[model samples]
Target: MADAELYAALGQLKLSYRECIVLQKIEGYSIKETAEILTCTEVQVRNHTERGMKALQKLLGGEIDEIG
Candidate 1:
């Protein structure tokens, strides 16, 4: 998808601030780095990543699962 389309879809997800930050790929940091940046535990980062991705996948009609 185009950047604009992806951004629009993401906006529709209404995610938490942390989820949005992580999903937006801020500098493409790993989970550890993201946890440090967000001042949260690595578990929280993983949770956000998983939940954000699931929401995105659902919103985008589950096409992400077909990528493989």
Candidate 2:
């Protein structure tokens, strides 16, 4: 995808600064690890990730897939 499309997808996800930071900056964790680090349940982390990805797909005008 083009840079603009990529950025637009990310932007459309509406992730808070903190959420984005946690997902992108930490980078070395499995979802479970990330959830633990964030002090949230694994389900919550998965939900956010699902929502974020869905939003991105919508923004990019791509097909949306079932989350998990």
* Candidate maximizing TM-score: 1
Off by over 4 Å in 2: 16-28, 63-68
TM-score of every model? 0.71, 0.61
Instruction: Report the lDDT tens digits of candidate 2 across residue range 1-68.
Output: 66565655565555543363346334546777777777888787777776676666766677544322
**lDDT (Cα atoms) of all candidates against the true structure:** 0.63, 0.60
Q: What's the lDDT for candidate 2?
A: 0.60
